[model samples]
Structures are given as C-alpha cells and as structure tokens.
Target: MAVEVGTTEPTEDVIDVKEVTRAERLRSMVARHRAKARKAAEQQRVNVARRVNEWFTSTDVTDAELAAEIERKRRREQHQGERELRDRVRMLREQLRAADENTAPALSAQLTAAQAQLQIRQDEDADRMKVSGRDLVRARWMKRATRIGAVGAGSLAYVNGVAAEPLLALLSLGAAPVAWLYLGREFATDEAPVVPAAVGPDGTPIANAAVPGTPFVPDTLAAMGRVSVVKPESGRVQGEKDLVTALIKAGIITAAQRDETHLAGVIRPSGPGWTATVDLPRGVKSSAAVSRVEDLASALRIKKSRIEISADTTDDGHEGRFVLWVANEDNPYGSEKHPSRLIDADRWDFWQQGIPLGGDARSTRHEMHLLWSSLLIGGLMGYGKSYMARLVAAAAALDPTVRIIVITGKTGPDWAPLRHIAHQWIAGATPDIIRRVLGVMEQTIGEMQDRGTELDRLYEEDPESVPEGKITPELAAKGMGPVLLVVDELQELLDGAALVQVAIEDEPEGGGRAKARSGRDLMVEGFARYVRVTRFVGGMGVFITQRPDADSVPTKLREVCAKRASYRVKGDRSAKMVLGDDAVANGAAPHLLGEASKGVVVLDQGDEQGHVTLKADVIDLPQFREICLRGRQLRIDAGTLTGDALEYGKEDAAAAAAALLLTDCLAGLNAAGIDRARTERLMELLAFHHPGRYGEMTRAQLQAQLRDAGAGTTKKIGAVDGMANANGYTREQIAAAVKTGK
Candidate 1:
C-alpha cells in the first residue's frame, strides 16, 4: 500500500487518548443527564398544555350541551305535567257536571281550587323558565372565567419556569369552579316558589280533608284541591272518545251533535262486558242507535252480536238516552247453557213470584208473570220457540195448583214430558187431533164460564175476598186453580192445510149445508176468544209458533197477547208480527239476532222500555222429566192430579180410539149443521174428512161400531140430500155416547 505514489499509505488521523480526571468524567455525565431531563421536561410541558387546552375546550362544549339537555328535560317534564293537569281538570269537570245536588257544592269547590292550582303551576313554570335562563347565562360566564383562569395560570407557570407544578395546581383549582358550575350552582340558584294548600270553607286544608267514598289523599300542597291523579277505571276515558267517533261514523249522530252527545256516566263493568249510558241529542231517539247496532259495531271494531243497545227507560224525559253494552267475548250469552232456576227448587209459586225465566245480558235474573198476561212466543224453527213453551210448562208443572194443558202440532218429544202433569195432553196434526183440540177449547170455554159464575158467587157471598173481581190465590188453593194452556207450533193448527167444513149460519139459501173453511180461521177464532176471555180469570195462555207471519199468527190474536217474545226471526217484519209494530219501532230487533243465538229472545211485556233482550233458561229433556215427576208427586199429595195425568198409560188404546171415533162423528155432524145424519152419510163425511182413518168404512161396520159405542140404536131418518130414509144416528146419541165414555 506504501508503494503507491499519491495515496500516502492510507494514513489514519490519530486521536489523542486523554486519561480524564474523575471530576471531568462526572461533568460530562451530568451534562448528558441534564440534556435528557430538559427534553423530557419539554415533552411534559407540551403534554400539560395539550391537556389543559383539551380540558378547557371540552368543558366549554360540555357545559353548553349540558345546559341544552337540562332545558330539554325541564320542558318535557313541564309539558307532561301540564297535560296531566289539563286531563285532571277535564275529568273533574265531567264528574262535577254529573254529580248530584248533594255533592255539587263540594265538587264546585274542588274545581275552583283546581283551577287556581293549575294557574299557579303554570305561573311557576313560567318563572322557572326565566330563572333557568338566568342561571344558564351565569353558568356559561363562570365556565369562561374558569377556562381563562386555567389558561392564564398555565401561561404564567410556563413563563416563570415553574410549568409542571403550577399548571397542575391551576388545573386542580379550576376544577372547583367547574364543579360549582355543574353541581353546586343548582343548589345555589333560587328555588321555585311553593304553592299554598287549598283550605275548605271550614278552614281545613283540602289536602287533609277526608273525601267520603273516594280514596283520594293528597301528599303535596300542590295536589290540594285536585282530583285523584289515578287514571279512570278501565278504558272509560278513551272509550268515550271512541264511542263518539264510532257513533258519528255509523250515522247514529251528526258531527254537529258531538257536543250534545256524550257518555252519561262512567263505563262500568257488567256481565262479561262493559256497560255505559250514552246521552244522544234531544231529537235523536235511542231506537236510532239500536237499529244501527251493526253499523256501530263495524265502526267500533267489534262483533255485531256482542253489542247490546237498549233504550234507557229509567228516566222519563230521556228518550235520547240508551244503554250500550260491549262484550269482550265473541258470544255475549256465553258458551255454557244457563239452567233453569227451578231445576234446584222443588216447587214454584206462579201467583206470588212468577217463574224464574232466565237472566239478562247484565246477569240480572228476570221473571215472567203468567198470572194475568198471555205470552206469545214466535221465532224460526229450532230457535227456542218450543223450548220456551216447554219452559213455561215446566214452571207451571212445578206448581201443583197450576193445571197445564199441552197441545203441540208436532208429535215430537218436546211436549211429552209435560204429559205427566198436563190436564189435557194432545199432540199431532191429524184431523182427529184438530177435533180433539176444538173439543178441549169448547171444554175450556165452558169451564171459564163456570169459573166466572163461581167468582160472581164468591163476590156475592164475600165481597172482600173478590174485591178485584179476579181469582185469588186463596180461591186457587181451594181447587179453583189457574190453568196454563201451551200451544206449541201453533202455525200447524193455524195453517192453510188445516181445513174443516163449518156450517154457514147466514147462508139460508144453501139449506144449512156447511161450507169449507180454513180450519185455521176456526182455531184462530177459538184461540182469540179463549185468550180474550180466560186471561181475566186465572188462565194464562202461552202460544208459540215458528212462523210468526200474519197468516200464522193473526193480528186479532197477537194484539190480545199482553206479553210477547221473539227469538231469531227471518226479518224485521216477522219480529214486528211477534213483538208488535210499536215494540219493533221502539227498539226491539229480534231479527238482528244471529242464527246461532238459539235461546236468546227479545221480550216485550208491554214495559215502558219497549223490550229487553235476554237468554232463555234451558231445560233439557231429563230436567224437564224430573221437574214433571216432582210436579206429579206434588199433585198427588195435593189430590189435584186429574185428567190425562191420572190415566196416562192405564187406558186401553183400542177402546180409546173407539171413543175418539165416536167423538169425531159428533164433531162431523156438528160441522154439517145437521142434528141427525144417516149412518152411511156420517161415515162418508168421516171418511171424506179423515180418509186415512175411515176411508174403507162400510155402513154395516159404522152401525155395528155405533151400537158397540152405546150410541143408541140405528133408526130410519129423513135424508137431507133428497134421498130415501135410511138407518141413521142423531147428534144427541153421539153426544150421549161421548159423555158415557167420559
């Protein structure tokens, strides 16, 4: 390497190897350490400055945000309180308006004090708002001061060479004002003005005053004179608005009538539902609402069958008032059947307590007074017409003094249980059955006349006993009992198919020959007469028919029936026919009842309220039979069991048929307007009227049967039809044979 001419052998610059003293080495080390400490100190100063700036900036932002949040919360709370106060005022006003005179003064005082308190609270809120604004301004200024102080102290510490310690102390001191602005200032601010408690006229604080019947006890002076803050029971408050809206939408009321139409009282609990009284406009009758129940239900979001609308008859001047009952359940009558009250009772007093028919929609028990009123029940088939008829029969059967007569056009078992207690039980739609029905009618009429005669005698003998000229319970107890005549499926006897030949008394040109007439007319006339005459003398008629049309139940008969019940019918026309035009117009809408509403019926007993809808008690076959057996035992014990009940299954069927044939012959002779008829003509008449029974009867056979029936010996008689004299029988002989059979 030394051999190169210009390289100078890659010379190394030699450093001086100085061996330093201890003091010199220590100085070097101290200088290095001091430099390192200075760098760290600078970093600490930067960090402190950054933290102080951050604290100031964040504190300013947080103070502003906190003020805004506090204001928002205060406003929200204030608004809620105001709204609640307003609602309380409204509720108290409503209660005051509805309060009675006795409670009105107290309610007025409470209202006055509530108004005053509400005003005070509003004023207090306004004052608090103003005070809050001042405090907010004050807090903001203090925060700015604290921020300035923190910055000034840090700047001073940095300038004076005491950065870390003084800045830390300044931050600590600044926290005091920050904490005061955030927390202590709230306590230092002026408090809200307190409201004075309301005192009654007796100088007692209303907050301390005990309210009778109410559980209102105020805890605060501000709560004095205010209504109970508890919410209204159930949905009454909200339901009122919904009801009004629904009514308006249903066209039950006009928008202009909204003010006048309101709930009369609080919606209270009823059976399976809630009941409320709606006060409609003066010109709007309750029937308007009742007729539009479907529309109301639709608007109210409920089932039509679950809405029960009835006129409020409790007040005389309130035709616009009605009761609205809304059920929560789908079927308001419930799923289970309501058994008859008589099921548990051994006997019933028809004259005293009447019959416990069933309960109503409100679970209120209802009774049917069968003493002086005749009931006319009509509905579609299988819609409780026969069941109701049997209910009446069962009620009557429970009373041994009540003589029951069961006659059903249907030969079903519906009326069979009644046979055990019935004085005269007849079932069928045959010609013979019609003849027997007429005979029973005639006998009932004769008995009614006899009863009238006996009552007249009683009046003559003891005027006090027969003051009302009506049968008394005492008279009924002494063997002169009430009679209950139930005719189920009455349309069968009052239909066009039920025909008979009746003598035309006015048709003198026809030589007293009979003219064919609808047997319904005869039956209607007889029934009308029976109901008209017998209702006054301890006789109650219960006529039930599925077809409640004009032809089935004539107006002549329907008008006389004082009590009427209509089950589910085809339309309003049928309901009107059963319940009367007035009843239907007033608020009776049996047609609105659904087909599934079997035992439900609209009952109109000529009440002021027009009609009431209720579910009839169900008395099944077994219960009916049990009741009948008990009735039979009671009758036996009282020695009152008679007629069909006495010889229910003991009589010979063949002999009874023969006796009934003889009776039919008498009825046929009467219809022909002839006192005497030849045996052949009588047989022909019987065969023509009742062809199924006597279609193949020969003259010899008729004579032999008549002789066997002790209907007197056959003799030659003049034939009315320009024929030769033939062996014949007289009406007197037939009537004699009937009496002999009895």
Candidate 2:
C-alpha cells in the first residue's frame, strides 16, 4: 500500500505543478492584454472626444449648446462602455465554469478581475453621494459640540466633587446634556455660500458654473465680488493686441487682414474706457464697421450698450475711420452732467445773447447765435429736427423782447410744447395756409427792411447809440425786438404750394393763374433773398426740413446760412447737402449716425473744422412744457409779449402798415441812387394801399400831405443822366420825422 501511494503522488505532483505553472502564465498574459486593451480603448475614446471638441473653435453655436452636445456624446460613450464591460464579464464567467479543476483557478482569477471591474462600473453608475458643503459644515459643528460638551461635563464633575454644591451640580448636569447633543451626528441645515450666476450685457443669466463635467460649465469659474463668472480675467481690456486677437477669434477680422482692419491708431483713456480711432480696411466702409459694432463689443467681452462706434468716411468713399468708444460702465452719455435749464442769462451774455441748443458730446454748451446768422437744420425723420426747432422757439420765447413765428407743416403733436409761446403758429400745409404763411413772410421781410432803415437812421443820428450796424441788446430792449422765424417741414411749402392768391378783380387781363403762384418762387425771390440780412434787423430764420434736396432746402439758402446742424441722414450725399460739401471728408458722417445715437448731430457753425459732434439735451415733453410755461410767464410779466398777429387798434395797424410800405417799396425802389418826387412813384406805391385817399390826387396834394405828416424832404438825388432837385423821402428822414412825431 505504501509503494502504490508514493508512485501515484509523484505522478500527480508532477502534473499538478506543470498545470499550475502553465495556467498561471496564461492568466498573467491575459491580465496584461486586458489592461493594454482597456487603455487603448480609453485612448481611442479620448481621441474621438478631442476631435469633436475641436469643432467648437469654428462652430457658430453658442457655448451652452456645444456643451450639451458634448454631454450627450459622453453619455452615449458611458452606456457603450458599460455594455462592453458586461459582455467581457459574462464571457469570463462562462470560460471559468467550462474550465477543468486544474485550469479553473486561472479562469476564476480572470472572472474575479472581470467581476471587480463590473463592480467598479456599477458603483460609478450608482451615483455615489459626494461630501457636500452641508456635510462639511455639519461635521465641523459636531466636532465643536463634542469639545464643548467634554469641557462642560468635566467642569460639572469637578464642581460636584470639590465644592459639593447642589446648585452647581444641577446646573452642570442640565448643561451636561451638551454631551448628549454632541453625540448626535446630525445637525440642522443652514444656508450655504454658493456661486452666483453670471449675467450678460442684456441681463441674460449665464449658467456657466455647476459640477465639473456638467453641461454649460466653464473651464474655470471665478467669483468676482458678487458676480460669479467664467473667465473673469478676459473681461478687462489689456491692449490693442489683445483686442485684435479677440476680434480675430470672434470672426470679425481675419488674421490675413491688414492693420487698417485691425485698428491702426493707439487707444487712449477717454472718460471711463479707452477710445481708439481705427482706419477701416481699404474695401470696408465705416458704415459697415458701425453696423457690426455690437458684434465687436461682444468679441471684446464688453457691454454692448456701453460702446460708441462713430464712423467717418472720405469724400471718395475709399477710406474711412471708426471711432470706437468703449466704456466699462453702461450709458457713457449719462456720465456727462448738463444744465437742465435752457435759459441761463450768464451763458446768454457769453454767447452774445445766442440760443443754447444743447450740450455737445463733450458736455459743452452749444450756444448758437441766430442774431446775424441763419440756421439750416436738416435730418432724417425721428431724428429730432422738429424738436430742435421747438428748442429754438422756446429760447426765443424766454426772452421777452423776442417774437416766435413757427410754421409747423408736420401737423403732428411734435410742436405742442411751443403752442403757448408761438406768435404766428401756422400748422398746416394747405394752399390757403401756405399762402397765408407767404404773406407772413412778406410782412416779416417788409418789417425787416423797415427795421434796417430804422437802424440806419439811429446810427446816423447817434453812432454810439447803435454799437454795431445791427440791432443791439439796447435796441431790442427798447422794443425794436427780435423775431425768430422758424419754418419746420419747409419741404411742404416748397412742394408747389400757393404763394399769394389774387382776386379776379386784381388779376390782369392775361387770364392765367395770375394770383396763384408757386410758394417756392416767392420764398426764393422774396423770403430767402432777405432772410440772412434780416438777422441784423432783429429777425432770424431757422429753416428745418427733413428733405435737404435742392428744391426743398435750396443751395442758395444753405450758402447764406452760416450755421448748419444735421442729424442721422440717408447717406453722405444728404449729410453734405445739409452740412457742406466737405462734411463727409472732414469726419461728419451723418450716415454712420443711427437711432441708437439719438440727439447726436454734426454741427457746422462756421468753424474752420467741418463739423463737430453735438449730443443734444434730452428734452422730454414734460420738461419742454415746463420751459414753455416759464417763458410765457416771463414774457407776460415783462409786458413784451407782442406777436405778429396780436390784436391792435386801427391807429396801430395803420402806423405799422405805413412803416412797412416806406421800407419795402419806397426805400427798395430808390436804392439805385435814383431821384424821384415823393408824389410821383412813392405816392403811387402808397396809393395802392390807400386808394381812396391818394389814387387820383395830384403830386402837389401828395407833397402837401407828406409835409403835413413831417416825412418829405428836399434833396439833390438822381442818376447821372436824370439829376434833378426834388422833394424826395429819404429812409433816415422818414424814420426821424416819424420817431419825433413832427
């Protein structure tokens, strides 16, 4: 029996040892291969994810959408990985069950490894609870409670043993409940500090921070005071190079583009943020750049509302520049403080009694002198042209000595603020209304001519009394006051409206439309002809029109007017039409102005530089009405609220009509140094008005009448061929006699 057992043991031991060695070697090889395969598969999946993520650089999709897509892809990969792990584990278990007892150990080892891998996979999928801020807080509180309770209990035991005081023991025992409280692991929940959501310029919240690997999360989220945001460092403007890189990354500019497209000028601090003057690319116009200002601002990571992109173009339209005004805070214009009141006597004196239109972009007051300067204001619709006209009228109204005549052809509520103070407020563009306006214009011209003669007589009488060869503050104070002739929507009148309608009796025998003439002709010949010169005679005209065409706002009138302010217009053509020929060339690109730049205008007030940017005051309807009320009250108190159409007595009307006739007809006819008797052509001109009095009277009768009224004079005045001695009425002589009431 011993010999047999020895022989069997030797054979079995040899086979078992060989089998163990072979199986162990196979298992080790399989383990290495499995590790290598898993690593290679993971590397392949990482490569695919990397390739997919690279699409974000060129994709136009938002970051949030891209993150969602990446998350979906990762979820898909996770599910596939779990399925593969399950298949591997099932195959390993089957192989272990089919193996014989000797090789079973190797297969079992493989199965165990597979099972462990599956368990790790399942554990990951189980959504294990991570230690949150609340847990950490509770743990800290528990530790502190334990320490305090231990101290309390020790103190209680010591007090009871040393002092043997019953009261202290009872208090300590009751407080020793701290030990029981500390033994409890749970703690009441408290509000935890959390990262705040970031917001965009439009107040859109950016959910850019959550758990790591979550969708819509940033690579690095930072807390900036109360604003928790992604890439907070990128919000600050570093330099031009950084801006250029951002632009390129934002697809606003290509790297191949030249420096002009990338902003050639240096950026400097202007108010809140830096301002840079960038020359647009050769092919790109400034208007194009202005259009994309929002995109540019977004690329720079700035608030879109805090950016100002003003553009200037050359005459040839080949070159242009963009003035980029970027501010850290919103509302750059709000930073400037402007006076609310329109009338400041001190500022008025500094402006030589000019009107304060508004403040410029630099917050400096834009005081325009309408005394000896006509104004041509033109702009697009809704660009504050009518509002500007109201401002002028309001300014005139504040001065008791100034008269306001407003021609509001718009027929809208835009001029409601000026109704209280307007002297001759014409509100329609009908034929009869325009004809009446023409009559008003004719009457104003006649009055201006009369004032000119009056001024000349005053100067001749006393040069010191008439400081300049025009109406002074003293003259205006003395009641020979100023008149603001505001014509808004002048295009309506110039669009072939009626001028002066003649009656059938007054019409000539030619039988044409004799009485009805075009208003444009009468305006060009009569009104605009003398409008500029009348400023010196206390009558200033403001021609405001949305259409700045040759017919609407004639070039002749534009040439006469020394000051022009234009708002956003159609293009450079319209800007030039309103401002001047060199407006666009000199950086007055009204075309680049937009509704976003409301109240911004390009003013050319006879400055050597073409035009300047004037950010007009924000005159709301309520404020305007208040200003009008104040002005009206002022005029009423001063007793100088006389208007062109105010009710007057018969004597006053006759005197005013006689003065108009003397200057408009007599003086104008005698301007060529021609001598004529007062009873000849002068009486004839007067007889047309007072036909019943002097139509058939003799020259002797007219001379007697004038001498009785203290107006005629004997003078040697004639042309070279027709020199004669006669009784002629000089303007100064008539003015003096009329003033002295001789």
* Candidate whose TM-score is highest: 1
Clashing pairs in 1: none
Question: TM-score, each model?
Answer: 0.56, 0.46
State the C-alpha lDDT per candidate: 0.73, 0.60
Model 1: how far residue 526 lies from native, Å: 1.2
Which residue pairs in candidate 2 collide?
none
C-alpha root-mean-square deviation, each candidate: 27.7, 32.1
- Which portions of model 2 show Cα errors greater than 4 Å? 1-266, 276-339, 343-353, 359-365, 410-413, 416-419, 496-516, 524-527, 548-551, 621-623, 644-742
Which lDDT tens digits does candidate 2 get at residues 1-742? 4554433344443457888899999999999999998987666566555533433232223232233344445447656776686677667766876889999998878776766675465445323223233443444455456666776898778866758665766776787556544433232233122333435558775432222211222212221221121223333544455556655655645788646564433333333345655665576666555556557767877655555555543343234665666654543454332333352111123125455566543334555666777788998878677666666666676677777777867687766656666677788877788678778877878887898999889889999988878787788777777777787887877773644443424557876544555566776665576676687777678889888777777887888888888888877688888988755554555666655666667787775434666666555667677666666666667676555334322344566645554454345445535434444666666566567655787877656655655665455545423445544665666666557552
Candidate 1, residue 38: the lDDT equals: 95
* lDDT score for candidate 1 against the true structure: 0.73
* Candidate 1 structure quality by residue, lDDT tens digits, 503-605: 4355667476545666667788888898889876888899988888988889999998999999999888999999998887777888888856888988999
